[model samples]
Target chain A: MDRGRLALSLIALAAALALPFVAGPFWTGLATQMYIFGLLALSVDLLLGHAGLFSLTHASFFAVSAYTVAILQVRYAVPTTLAAPAGILAGTLLAAVFGISVRTRGVYFILITIALGYVVWGVAHRWSSFTGGDNGVTNVPFPAIGGVGITSHTQYYYLVLAVILLCALGYRVLIRSPFGLGLRGIKASETRMQSLGYRTSAHLYAAFVLSGALASLAGVLYVYYNRFVNPVASSFPISVEAALMAIVGGSGTIIGPFLGAGVVLGLRNWVSSFFEMHHAIMGAVFIATVLWAPDGLVGIAARLRARFSRPKEPGP
Target chain B: MTQLAIEVGALAKVFGGLAAVDGVSLSVPAGERRVLIGPNGAGKTTLFHCITGTLKPTRGSVRLFGRDVTRDPEHRRTALGMGRTFQITNVFPDLTLLENMTLAIVGTDRRKWVMHRAVAAFADVRRQALEGLEAVGLAGRAAQPVKLVSYGERRQLELALALNTRPKVLFLDEPCAGLSPSERQRISKMIAGLPRDITLVMIEHDMDVALGLADRVTVLHQGRVILEGTPDEVRANAEVREVYFGHG
Candidate 1:
């Protein structure tokens, strides 16, 4: 709430609002993808950064939502409006069931979540009747809100931006609340928290359900914007991408994941044009970032600004 | 008659073939200052863990304030007014001393899950946390992170964490385990000044400190009580002198 933070937030908001006007159509399309990815990254941050859970199965939730929208629209002839909520509800229920069981053990917890992600992926691939299987569901309808259809690319871009901003605000409020502090305490030391009469498992289960719902929202947006749903959307590599984005931006901080998503997603779109080994380059960059800025880019930037702005003491 | 703060009846804990806590039974009346002393590996810590519900006993029951809490979890025991300090100091290193104590007090209040309420707005919680720190003579270092404080101060912070919960029964595990003589003396005075209404049970290896503080003493050997009586009676017992105190 300081002047500096307020100013930074306002500036970022202005940039996001102005992006469509300044960028070409192709770049505008890519930025929209980044915003969707940013929402997914923020959800992952809630678990990994705040709750001290390391997960590699969030893509299952994402895929669940995307597939629900695709299948409902294509097979069951369900309207887009109803499908969105239904998909989110499905993802939340699935996540809660998995979260309750997996949140018990330590390292094995993470492994089980990964295995669950693979299980979902296998189902999506093998069940061709409903999912369209390997080829995916294509020509999904555009979202229409209150009879206002969003068919143009610019309209879709603004829709993604609006959802991202709303979710970001929600994340901000949640993290500043008492529940957020409990999650931080859970992260710092579970044994100490338990001794203070906190049932940590219940808190973790709720967080998982909430995070899954949010990830599913992103998945719904992705299906709307692209008019397609693919098996790769729920693949392990995409889950890894979400984790890396959360880390690169800064985990617990609200804006960190969004900033991380913008940078990495932007870089991928820019470099894929000419490079054949973009994945290798991204891997190297990830290694370097981990070594040099373990706290992420925001932490590095803060340290640099502090060094120059603060008064220095003379050597004795 | 005063209520029994803790009642352990025929408690036994077995890991594989070894009996960690073998058939231990004792009772401490409300407001009594009791100490258990023995050599290393005498199952003192194991008994503490069982009473606190950290480790489930294979047999017998533990009752706190006439409620059977034998199968309860550690958190449930904590909620029922049983405060404990670990043998190893456990304070939040990254958080300030005030924040560490505040967490305990807030957690104990059962309002920690109120997501929208700001912690700073809770004036009563802040006041109680500060009072707990002051009780341990840590008021001056309240703003400093616990990691920045000395080892002795960190130990005091651990005690402060327990006190903020306002428990009816306090279990101090080696309250002076690694303290310097001066630090040990200060902690001794602190413990001696606690409200008489709070039942105190502690495990101590320092015989001199235990004798000075405890109204009654129990000596354990290899997982069983060898002697139990008033401090004077325990000191006079022949078997305790030969087997534990190394004198006859």
Candidate 2:
């Protein structure tokens, strides 16, 4: 990272560390949700921004993992150590199956993922015997490992903040890796990549699976934070919202998704309090974003910086 | 006896009712520079595509160094020492020229699967990518995005990308198709300077560039080889003149 970016990151870290103490429980709670969903959006961007695959079934992985943890911990009395990995494993396995959708490109890939997502949603919504119907697996306790445990929301916020920071750092490394470069090349021209000796389908499938695994991680953080795994967690809007967050923040950058999640969740929370149809306002904002700021907030920031810092030149 | 680097027997490709390549048979000896010349719709590209495993032929076999690879996928063929440049310039526009070259360098190896370390950590790949770019006269433009470079430079990078794949048999599809005379000379000089140990199969519209680099030339008319001979023999053939250059 450049010195400026490093400084910015340190300041952001300090602010995040102090948020719960200064802002109270509500803001801490909201900030916690932002980090979780931001991780989810970061996963979606792995394919969307890097590999150029638009997947609509991330919610499937997210919710499946959440439900797995909720069921294992609540009903079976499983410890956090086993249940968390189990949730990630279940979600990742589903992603492997859904990874077959990579065979089709463009609209077909989108359609297949949507259909697959609906299958998961239908099971979560209608499977009352095991999934607890619409009420879902509830009264889930905060994640506790052996004697050390999270006692309150403020403490949990710090844990989440730590996890997200680690994830962002790891994500930074992954994107700059050789494997990551191959994904970007595939995005530019699959034919060229194939001729360059890459199995484009295999590359895309691997990316899809990894992306699903990340979404699954976010889902684990979420159920513990929200204290339940409902059908809404697996709904289509959740997947769409995750993608929208990535786009609205800056699809390719690490911090962009987190910033986007803050904008989206903050707006929804503030708008819904006064207006009955806040969804319409959200819709308008998204349309405006697409029309005028297609590159999202980060792109806008870059443009503004370039404009302001451009050197003056003499003209005839 | 000279070994055959590439052998194709009765190759045919049919798209709907039209046969793009029909009953084409060819054999190129190892380390020989061969050029295919034909009119616009003479199935030269289709033939190249079938041989390189880009498009599966409807019928016939393709053998590389005595091994049949008719059913192998494109990347598999690339692994088996086949590399090709597209007729059109195809490259990673968003990535820097060095990044594009790096992808080509690690593409045929296990390093492409290495995700833990950054690409810059591979000092050897960086050096080789720079060397590859330098060979193509694009070393100075390594940090520039391919989109920002000149079209002629992209053509050069396209060839560089193919060379970095370590192909024993290099297929060049109109390597100088859209270059100015000087740019064409530069690309052709690069092709001519390539080590003769690597087999070259090229499609060219410019007869001067084609005949100058080709050890032998094959003329195709209506999806079949009309004549195969030395550059001088092809130039002297009346049949090639009638079909390739239109009527007298």
Candidate 3:
């Protein structure tokens, strides 16, 4: 990584680590929520930005993990830690299976993923005996590491931050790896990659599994933080929010989605405090951002910096 | 009598009602440099696609290194020591020239799945990629994004990508299409300098280029091979002269 990028990453990490100390209870809770959403947004960006796969079913995997944790802890008497891995495993496996069928290019893939999301939502909603149907799974417990339990809001906030940081680092490493290059190769030209001896489907499937696993991890954190899981967790609006965060942050950069999550979630909290129509405000912001900053906020900033910086001559 | 690098026996490909490639049979011996020349709609590109496994033959078989590769996918074919370049320049425009060649080398490498390992960590891959770029004279432009390079350079990058795979048989589709006269001469020289062990099969529109580079030339007309001989024999053939080489 270049010096500028390294500096930016360290600064962002520092800000995140310092947020809990300065913010109040309500603000801290919101910030924690944003961090979880940031993880989800980043996972979505892996598929959309890196793999060039537009998936609308990511929230399905999220809700699957959330509901898995809820059902295992509340209904089956399983501990939260064991149940968290189980949920993530289920979500990853399901996403991998769906990826096989949904790996087609263009709008077909998007539609298939959307249909898969609806199918997951329908099952969760209809299976009332296990999922509690529309009421959702409730009384989910805080995650614990052996004897050290996340009991308070502050402790839970730190826990979410730790997981987010670890996952983000893993994402960074994965995106810079050979597998990541293969995905980018697929994105650039699937035919060319195929001609170069890469099975593009295998790369896409791996990306789908990784994205699903990350989304599931976020879902597990979300359920633990909120102490509840609802059908709305798998709703289209949640998926839209994840996509919007990714797009608004600049999908080209790995950290853009997380940055976008912070800004969008912060704005939502600010707007909802004064207005009854939070959705309308968010919708307006989405429209405006797409129009004015199609490359996203990071792209806009990069453009400005480039405009003011000293120009370099073209290379030989 | 030398081992055949590629052998096509009665290959045919039909798209809906039209036969894109029809009963085409040809053999390219190992270490041979051959050219396929035909006017537009002679199925030159279609034959290249079939050989590379992009389009499966409706009948007959394609053998690479005497092994039947008719059922393999394009990637499998590439892994089986057949490399191809598109008629239109195909390169990662967003990536640097070095990165583009590195990606090709990485693809050909067996250890491509180990995530988090720096691609440059492998000294051999880096060396091979640089060597491939040097072969096409793009070594100095290594760090420049392919999009920043001129059109001729992009073509060279495409050749570098194909060469990076270290294929036994290299198939180039119109490698000199859209180059200036000087650029064409440079590419012709580069092609002529390739290792003798690497069999070169190319589609060329320019008769002078075909005559200069190819040890053997095959002319395709209406999806079938009309003539196959030495460049002099092909140039002297009455049918080839009348159907293809005649002035418009």
Candidate 4:
């Protein structure tokens, strides 16, 4: 961390802290969504960027956790304390089962996760008796403890900010850890990792489960913020969008996913205001990203910085 | 009586209808430098894979230090004191040499599972990685990524990765493959200098390095062991000259 970067980071942090006051409620709300979804993208990157696994079933965990929190809180009148943890546990358990997808690789891996995700979406969409189907479980209240409760969306935004910030800090330590490096090694070459004494499958399974747990946490936050849970939360596009967010922002870095979330969500809001084929615009953006900036906006920024920083040689 | 370091009993690996390793069996005693030399397509690497648990044999079992490990996976074999280098260089190209060595150092132990602490914080692991790199003459290039190093350096990193795991039975699959003559001598000297307590199983195409380092030689042709004897005997055998030298 250089002085320049540190100063820049502090400025960014200050801006984020002062955003709700400076900007109107709309921008605050959108920023909040960006942070929440950014966390989901970060979770996906744990496997995608590090372990070299491309899982499309992450939304299953996200929705399962969200639905659990919604139903428990809204229907059974469970407190946020129990419901949130329970939601995370439920999502993590599903991830553990889904982690078996690590047994396959390449196209087979992608296919299995897609199929698994569809099963969850199908249950949420078709199982009307318990799941409440398309309408889903609604009127979920804001999280409230014994004495303290978040009464408004603005306060909830701050809460989301605080939680994601802590998560980001923790994630920084984690990615720099030996286990994290092991994941990178596996990504570079799994066969070599195995010969080097790593059970590549087991490392991947653990990463999958951990990634799912993070997504589950995001889901709990989403449920509280949106005040509802729907089948759309578990849909395939959400999973795809999450992966895209990580890729667009930078798959391997912390700020990259959040930055990518801002790009995607902000682009949608801005473009859909007047554009009829807003999704088409998104498709084009993704295409451009893959063709020119495969490492995401973060990588592009790095290239620019390097180019500018290098001193020019004297004339021949 | 010499203790058996590795015992492959009737090992076979078949790819569809083709038996790449067709019922090959070997017994290398502890503290012996056993080299396997054979022509291309003789299933030398396949046999090495089976013995190192890279590929499972369709029949027979592999044992390490008299323990049944045929069912064990590659990582488990490494944990049970078996380590190997690939015939083709297989170091992690994206990782720094230090990180590569760090992985090999912590691989067999519980430290590899520690997720909370950054790798840089482990001073002892870093020290050991540097020392291990020094052993392979790679200490100066510790911070460099494998991709930046020359192919010869990558080969040395390959051997370093295996040695850091602290294996009792070491397998080097053409460890000197694709190197200059001087580089070949450097690697062969490294192999020959290894402690005799560690069982050495190597596959080499260079007859000079192979015979010079080997206490005994095993010759394979058409996926079967054709000769297993002392280096002098293997060099003298007319059948070997006919097959290995292609004089027949």
Candidate 5:
């Protein structure tokens, strides 16, 4: 809403619109992946950044939705309209059940989510007949509604960009709402919040379900784009990485998670080309981020902006 | 006869083997300013917690306006017209003072659940929040985060938060615990200025502030009320002097 943010957003939008035309297919594909993973991270942050809940079971919802869409589309020939909504619903229902994790806090919440994630991953991996085992459901066609079909990756890229933009706008509105402020209040002090007539646990549970639903939405987008699904989508690593992307980018802000996704996925793609142990570099990045820039890239940028701009402003 | 705003019968709170609040009974009438005073470890705060529903009593009952509410949760008690300020100044540190007030204003009402619209869009909430701040002499610091404000200001905001909940019975747990003398006077003045319709229950270590504000005083020693009377009677009691003043 500020002039600086508006200008920056317009520039980012123009670049996103032009990337498919200007860049190669590989770059466009990578950018699309960034947006998808970015959405996943954003979902994690809805709890992590605002409500002070660090969830690691988000991959369960993501993968559950992805598997649902993949199986419905590939095995049963379900249309995108039904398959997509069904995927999101399955994931969200799972979230509603998994949402009981709100009963625990701190490391216990993380451990429970990790355990729940493995349950989903285990089913996806061990249940060979239904889930296609390790290979997962494959040959899923691109999302098509009615007569209009996404015939090319480039066309799908635009669809994803539009969805993410709309989601970001909604997320912005949500964080500014009274419910959003209540989440921040809980984050600050749950005891005080309870005394203020807030049912803190219920507030947190609602946020968890909503975050899971958003992550499920991302899963739908991902399955359509990747054209397949696998147990890796449900694995613990994916959940950790989604959370890490939010942290490395800026856990609280909208653009921070996307920026983090870009850094992470971009690093992995570029590093894995030559280095066999690229994960070490990722670990180092996380450690350095935690040690020096705990607020992520957004915090660093904010500090830099303040440093440079404060000198020019008149005394308060 | 005046109605009792708060009634506690045979209340006791035990933590493991220790009874923090051992078998205490208290009744405060509507529109009375009742102050609970004692030496350290006398269970004043523990008693407040049980009455406010922050901690469940091991045995006994708490009633508000003749309605038994011992089974209710803290928020439910708050909804039932009970509000309290913490001794250690509990508040939302990251939120602006106005936002803090807004939470309190909407807390007891259904409006706290409104999610679609931004908080600022609620013009009435904003106006009420400002008025709440103004009442606590914090209107100038409305835009500042609670963390950035002085401790004295946070204490005021703490009282402001409780007041905005619109409780019929208000509890203050050492509201001026760590304030300067001037700050203490300001807070006591705010407490004194509150309408007589709002029943006040306070715990104060400062005897001057305690006696000046109380319609009646209850003296506690070792988790039991040793004496209860007017300020003059409490001050002149030989047992109070022997136990409270540490001399016969």
Candidate 6:
């Protein structure tokens, strides 16, 4: 990390840490949502931005994890110590199975993931006896360990902020790693990568599962924060929105997804207050982003910075 | 007394009722430099693909170091000491040359799976990457992305990517496919200077580079080997003139 980026991250951390005490409850809650959804988007980008696999089934892992935590905790009275890990493990296991989808590429990969996601959604929506149908599993409390537990939403927000911060740091390391570069190489040219002796399919499969695990982590965070799990959590729209968040912010950067989540959530919150056609507006925004700023908002910001900082000297 | 490095037995590849490579068999001894030359659409590239496992032969088998690898996938072929450069300059355009070399250096090894450590932290990888770039005369431009470099430089990077994999048998599909006279000489010289311990099979349209570099030449016409011999025999043959040299 450069000095400027490090300083910016420190400032963002400080602001996030101080948000609950400094800002209103609504803003803090919104920030928490942003972090959670941003993490989800980051997971999706692991394949989308790096491996060039556009998966439409990440929400399956997210909802599977959330539902696992909800059922294990609410119905079976499982402890947080057991339920949280089980939730993550269950979601990660689903991701491992779905990792087989990496055998396909481009449109086929996208279609397979879509079908896989729908299977999970169908189960969550139609399996009423166990899933509770549309009402979902409720009366879920905040996550706690032994006697030390979250008593307020503010505390949960801080916990989520902390976890996401750690995740971002880890994600940064992963992207800068050799394995990460390998993913980007595979994205650029799979044949070339194979010629260079990389087992491209295996590389992509690993990335898919790791991405799923991250999405599962996001799901666990979501269940604890929302206090419930429903079929909506597993729906197609959430998956699309998570991907859109990454694209809208910037697909390749770590902070981009979070910033994108904030933008999407903030816009939805503000726009729906007055306009009934907010979704149409969202569509327009996405189209504009794709057309005018294909690299997303971060790329725009970088370009602007480069333009402004260019030397004023006359000679080249 | 040389061991056979690559042995192909009656290989055939068919596409939509047309045979691209039909009933071709060739054996290359270890440490020999062999070149394949033919007119356009003579199945030279198709033959290269079949040998490298990029395109599976419809019939027959391929052996590497006397081991049958006919069923091996392209990547497994790579791991078993086979490496190739494409006719087109194929490389990671968005990555810096160092990164490109880094992938090649660690690709055949387990280091490509180290997800926790930053690539910058791998001092050996970085050093070897720089050295690999240096071998291609690209160390000065190590930090530049592949797309920013000239086509000739990308071609060099292509050869560099293949070479860094430490293959026992290396295949070059027109490594100097598009280049100026000077750039072509430079690349051909680079190929000629490679350690003779590694087996080399190359496809070249430039007969001067092909005949000059080959220990022996194989000429293909319409997917069958028409002739195989020393450069002098291939040059003076009346049949080669009609089909390949265009005049006796």
Among these predictions, the greatest lDDT belongs to 2
Instruction: Report clash pairs, candidate 1.
Output: none
lDDT of each: 0.85, 0.95, 0.87, 0.94, 0.94, 0.93
- lDDT by residue for model 5 over A1-316, one digit each (tens)? 8999899999999999999999999999999999999999999999999999999999999999999999999889999999999999999999999999999999999889889999999999999999999999899899999989999999999999999999999998889888899999999988888898998899899999999999999999999999999999999989988999999999889999999999999999999999999989889999999999999999999999999888676679
Candidate 4, lDDT over the whole model:
0.94
Interface RMSD of each: 1.5, 0.5, 1.1, 0.8, 0.8, 0.7
Model 5 chain A: which ten-residue window has the lowest total lDDT? A306-315
Off by over 4 Å in 5: A312-316
lDDT per residue for candidate 4 within B32-61, as digits (tens), equals 999999999999999999988888899989
C-alpha displacement of B140 in model 1, angstroms? 3.8
For model 4, the superposed segments whose C-alpha errors exceed 4 Å read none
Model 6 agreement with the true structure over A195-290: per-residue lDDT tens digits: 888889999999999999999999999999999989999999899899999999999899888889999999999999999999887898899999
Misplaced by over 4 Å in model 1 are none
Please give the clash total of every predicted structure, in order.
0, 0, 0, 0, 0, 0
Candidate 2, residue B185: lDDT: 98
Error of 4 at A137 (Å): 1.4
Model 4: per-residue lDDT, tens digit, A1-316? 8999899889989999999999999999999999999999999999999888899999999999999999999889999999999999999999999999999999899999999999999999999989999999999999988779999989999999999999998888888888899999999888878877899898889999999999999999999999998999999999999999999999899999999999999999999999989999889889999999999999999999999999998999
- Sort the candidates on TM-score, descending order: 2, 6, 4, 5, 3, 1
Query: What does fnat come to for each candidate?
Result: 0.54, 0.88, 0.68, 0.85, 0.79, 0.87
- TM value for model 2: 0.99
| Span of 10 residues, lowest total lDDT, candidate 6 chain B | B239-248
User: Chain A of candidate 1: what's the TM-score?
Assistant: 0.96
Could you tell me how far off, in angstroms, the CA of residue A299 lies in candidate 6 after the best superposition?
0.8
How well is each residue in B1-248 modelled by candidate 6, as lDDT tens digits? 77999998998999989888889889899999999988999999999999888887889899999999999988889999999999988899999999999999999999999999999999999999999889989999899998899999999999999999999999999998889999999999999999999999999999999999999999898888899999999998888989997875
lDDT per residue as tens, model 3, A119-195: 88898889888788999998888887678788899989888888887887788778777788788888888888888
Tens-place lDDT per residue, model 1, A208-247, is: 8889889999899888988899899889888888888888
* Deviating ranges (above 4 Å) for candidate 6: A313-316
Compute the lDDT of residue A80 as modeled in candidate 3: 68
Give the per-residue lDDT digits (tens) of candidate 1, residues B1-248. 98999999999888899997899999999999999988788899999989987788999899999999998988889889999888988777777887787788877665777766666777887798888888899999989987799999988887888777778999999988899999999998899999999999999888889999998998888889988899899888899888886778
